[model samples]
Target: MAGEHEHRDVSGGWLRAAVFGATDGLVTNSSLIAGVGGGGGAHHTIVLTGMAGLVAGAFSMATGEYISVTTQNEAIHAEVANEKAALAQDPVGEIAELADTYIARGVSPATAKAFATELAASPKDALHVHVQEELGVDAQKLPGAWTAAISSFLSFSLGALLPLLPYLLGLSSLPVALAVSAIALMAAGALAALLTGRSPIQSGLRQLLLGALAVGATYLIGHLLGAHV
Candidate 1:
């Protein structure tokens, strides 16, 4: 057992939603804060803007994730129903198809036929195999729309809260806000890379750079527009 290891369950849809929502929240709120501060907005205005962005972005991410996951699950369910009908109407042809599939995967023709025939004796087993081979998803493991939605909402709120903390605490310093957000962004990227088995340093730096770019661009635009206005 020393050398044996199990792989992480990366197939769950919640992780994706959480990571995307968090990163979007960090980037979006940070940029909004930078823009408002650069435009010479008062402390109260910046705080209000950050709070609004956090609430709106979290809800948006949750709704989008729920709808997307639900639609995909429905599509998979429809395909499964179709496969079930085919199994009932033409059992023999379905058995032959399963055998052919095994054969294509290098099982001998005789063994494949024998195995497929034996498997067909159980309707549930036959349906499961056919669905996996044809549709490429586990009928028993469909993603939960509520799970993804909740994860997105919570993660986005947490991420968006980081940058606004300084202002909310009455620091009223954009530099302090950006510094805190920068650290959080890099830490988040590193954590994601660690989970997915990638280079944490590379991912962290990439996140930091991209966030800085967005903040910088927004700040510059706000500054220019404020000057003119």
Candidate 2:
């Protein structure tokens, strides 16, 4: 047990959805706030814009995640069904193919044939093995569509709420909101880096820089538009 360590389940779709949703939410809301504030918008108007962005963005992310995950699952299921039909129609050929796969992977021909034949004894086992070997996917570990959708929805809401919190609390300070959102963006990046075994400092700076660009561009556009209009 000393040397054995458990690996994180990166296969599930929730991690990607949550990270992307949260990052997008923070950047989008912060940029929206900056743009409106730069455009000489009143506090109440900025708050309203932020709120609308949060709601609309969250729903959009959730809907997109759900549809994407569902479509992927459906495609995987179709492939699995095809594999099942193949196994049923040609058990011998399927087993031979599986054995050849193993032999190609440095397994002895005799052992591969024996192992494939043994696995072929059970329909479920044979199907699972064939599907995994052929498709490189675990039939049992398919990502949940609802799980991804809900994760996206909740994470996006939380991220988008960070910049809006200042206005919601009656602060009406654009600088304070920007500071908070910037910190949050860096923190989210650092956390993601830690999860993925990357350099936290680099990741955090990357997020900060990217968010700054978005905010700056929007703010400049808003300022120019406000001056003209």
Per-model clash counts, in order, read: 0, 0
lDDT of 1 by residue, 1-229 (tens): 7999888657667787788788888999999999999999999999999999999999999999899999999999999999999999999999999999999999999999999999999999999999999988888888899999999999999999999999989999999999999999998898778468889988899999999999999999989888888
Q: List the candidates' TM-scores in order.
A: 0.92, 0.93
lDDT of every predicted structure (CA atoms): 0.92, 0.94
Model 2 spans with C-alpha error above 4 angstroms: 1-3
| Tens-digit lDDT track of model 2 for 1-229 | 7999887667757887898899999999999999999999999999999999999999999999999999999999999999999999999999999999999999999999999999989999999999999999998899999999999999999999999999999999999999999999998899778567789998899999999999999999999998888
How displaced is residue 28 in candidate 2, in Å?
1.0
Candidate 2, residue 66: CA error in Å? 1.0
Candidate RMSDs in Å, in order, are 1.8, 1.7
Clashing pairs in 2: none
Ten residues in a row with the worst lDDT in model 1?
Answer: 8-17
